[model samples]
Target: MSASVPRLLVVGGNGFLGSAICRLAVGKGWDVSSMSSSGKPYATPAGHTPAWAPRVKWHAASAFSPDSYSTLIGESTAVVHTLGILLEDVGYKQSVKSGDVFGLVKSFASSLSGGDGNPLKSEEERKRGYEGMNKDSALTVLDTLISTTPPTSTQTRPFVYISAADAFRPVVPRRYIETKRQAEIEIMRKCDEHPEAGVRPTFIRPGLMYHPHIRPLTTLPAFLVDLSAKLSTASGLPNPFASKSPLHGALESLRTYPLHVDHVAAAVLKCIEEGRGGVVEVPEMRDWAGLGSKKKAEVGLQGQ
Candidate 1:
């Protein structure tokens, strides 16, 4: 499915990280197409469309329903799955739009035990929890990718899965990281089990990605989160704020450093360009984009 012009298909492209990937990829001259449930990017506060919106072919469809968007998927030399959920109680968009950070954090705290039931209870239950959104959605799309085209063992198409770096502390549900790891394992198994399928799978695990323009609400928390994460790394100190609030402290230590969304987006393109299959960690993601995590951490801190 490789093309001379380097076409890219971004599943869930209307999202924050997804939108960054689409915008960056378009600037780099890739023929980019985005598919989201909404089929379009969010309008600015002024109710105007972005200039880059016209450059991308937006499709409204679910990744689970490949029949609706397979032609778009198949035409691309590379594909990215950027769809996943953080909490079970509220939708990602709902959490962000409501501007209730503390409430979202409390929701994560409540669901840590995974008592809600197995998210992978069935293929149809793809949004119930971590397993369904993070793991099954990815597997479903890969199934579509493999089944859509005949295997050419030598073709070497690349599929990038947006996995997480995981919570260093127990802030998020254990299933959140577990489900993402499950996706990586299953993706690797599928690609290896079908070498003739010509799909090389890669996992880019980013941590606490923040952006100023898209999700300004995440920036302040990332600043404080980064400070704690750095302290933990440097001195092996526990979260200083633990006595005040253990859950929020753990959330801050979720990653050793926060990442700018655009940097992660750039790293995804770097992974796709290489067409190699493997796990890429946070530090490597920063390096590939020629930016250090510390620098980007401050940028996010400044809300720049």
Candidate 2:
């Protein structure tokens, strides 16, 4: 008989969203393995591992180096690309260019210790950094899958890209949004180029997501955001969280924006379980999580 458990590889398994995916996938009976350059979950300074660390097979691999993960990609039933950075500094980007795969990640993660910051000063620099780390790295993962997975394999392998709702928000930098747009374009380009390859490409555009205990810092802010959203409706004013809003995009996120991190994880798992390909917007993601859909809109839900 055919194997019942699906083999899944999460490229950023130890990260916030990735770890959630790993845990949720495990609960769904998927044989899940996580890949990261560190080859382990992030631990406290005291060296205490995360509680979910033992549930996954951790593999050391860098998204920049496709060779390091070709074997794992070939053997997986589905692969999720959850790797990307929100900040980029010239010095750190230079270090990453010199084969320091973890340098950019380390610096980016450090910046998040406080709040969001953009170090790429110029549009040119932002474009280059976003394309390299976000767009190119994702394409590398797809390249590895295309080269490693045999065409004869009958299993329907879905490639899930963890894109963001901010990609469409006007408050976000245009370069950042365009970078993610480019990545989605590349995924579709590859699908069109290899129609018979059987590699399904899916893009999950999630809104701001926060975990209660996992990221306690955002819990209160999420609460306030949610409150502000409700007040906006009561006041009969324009929705602050609307994508078309030139301002208050970040502010509106408090009420109508942030989703639970587990919701994103569950949405991804559902996408894989059903072998569905296309864009899954925030509302559908929340629906898949059984949180009940707050909105009925779907941005770009396509099918093969």
Candidate 3:
């Protein structure tokens, strides 16, 4: 795995988490490229790329269309799929903004009932749904990797999927986490079927990743999560994350453990360097970043 200088292809590299991974990858002196719908980081100045963007190749491409990135996959030794959705539609945020308890209850009911995601670039919906965005999009990358890499290749290149913990099970649509799991399962299945393929799977299941400077709104909630972690250590509870807590139904976001996005990016880099494969959880990520139980910083927050 460490035989050659690593070349990384980050799918959705311009998004909130994607950019962080790309930044860390670039910092490692790795040859990095990012494929985002916009072809560049968000909020780029007119006719000017960000300073960090120069070292990286940014492709404005669609996740469903492999043609947009097949050539890149052939050149890349590793790939990271960061594209996914958390809700089928405007679920909890809308209800919370209006303080509509009835609406909130109705949203929960609709989530329980389950529904389809937005269509892929459906001119009507103009967005991809869970099936397309979460599962199929990663498959698109896997299929492209299989097609582009040679069967005689001996080295293993890691494919990292940015997945979610089941923290939103209480409030969000069930399909949100389900699609994530399916993506991981299917990616592994494909690699198993094609043992000679260049891709190896690593799934990152982070819960409520917060960037205080980049996403100020998540600052307060992240502080709460860290405090809970400190409490869990002192109290000797099995875990402090409210993923299974009864009150999760009321305040899911705050109660869930919050991992910092920077730590997550660092962990991804470590996983690839160590040639590690398998599903990695939130606490493990902090440990991988050498943060362990005392993860605290008054830092600030987003995309590649």
Candidate 4:
């Protein structure tokens, strides 16, 4: 990679959205570094998939503990925290088993917050998990970068935070959305208060995301999900969207203002490239995803 190119550090880079960002960033010629507890980025044959693994530098680290990757963070021009959990349980365990490193650090912090060493077993435990992983982790990364890694210039370093659009979704627990909201509140407050900290925190709230292959098949189901998702906000319905059934989950992914996984990933890169910061809701997601004027117009009609 060219030295003039910007360097990016993606926490949770092995996950669904983070992997996409790395692929796109590599294509853009940015020097990319991915940090996760697992320390491995997804890879496939160059012809079989987009060849991004060759270009990215992967590191093992916990998002909750700044010290794990603090030294590597100093030289990055941007950092994206795509850390979150829809719900906590067996699915989360499976992710860990796959070496996802998605929320391990946050889980540890959550445990500490609850004054318990045991895994999440109660509502209170779950709340602490969301608080530590979803809210505090973002602040921790920003704090680590600001304190340890001064920007090379006066320009604020971009920090992209991936929050959820379904924070108000009825079927899901309120704690999930509330914790994410808390994260946004604390992060934006820090940005507002400390302009010289060299951190520009950008929050991207993505709608339900799905792979393109399955998306086209779910247009009507997705529409239904969207309607239900809207009512969910006011009704405060319990979110059952986390079903392990492949068919159920695939269809459920359409609800809550669905976007393709690639679109979500593209939005993050666009934020960093444009040096934009602040909240990016569903409507703005496509624009940043580079859907162009025509697609953007269609997205607007969806009223996401």
Best by lDDT: 1
Task: Assess each prediction's global lDDT (C-alpha) against the native.
Answer: 0.76, 0.71, 0.75, 0.69
The clash number for model 4 is: 4
Every model's Cα RMSD, please? 7.0, 7.5, 8.3, 8.9
Q: On a 0 to 1 TM-score scale, where does candidate 2 land against the true structure?
A: 0.76
- What pairs collide in candidate 3? 19-304, 39-60, 213-300, 213-301, 214-300, 214-301
Cα distance off (Å), candidate 4, residue 24: 0.4
Candidate whose TM-score is highest: 1
Please provide, for model 3 over 119-182, each residue's C-alpha lDDT reduced to its tens digit, 9 standing for 90 to 100.
3446434335677778888898889887776524688878899988776655666667778888
Clashes of each: 0, 4, 6, 4
Clashing pairs in 2: 225-254, 225-255, 226-254, 226-255
Work out the TM-score per prediction. 0.82, 0.76, 0.78, 0.70
lDDT of candidate 1 at residue 247, scale 0 to 100: 60
* Candidate 4 C-alpha lDDT tens digits along 1-304: 1246888999888767788888888998888999887897665322234456868998999877778988888888889998777654424434343434545445434433533234545745643466767887788888888786465556578888999874333334456667888888988888778777778888898766655332333344446666775565557555564553334433334434666778888888888877778888876885565643322335456755
Name the runs in model 4 displaced over 4 angstroms.
1-3, 43-50, 92-128, 212-256, 288-304
Residue 235 in candidate 1, Cα distance off native in Å: 2.8
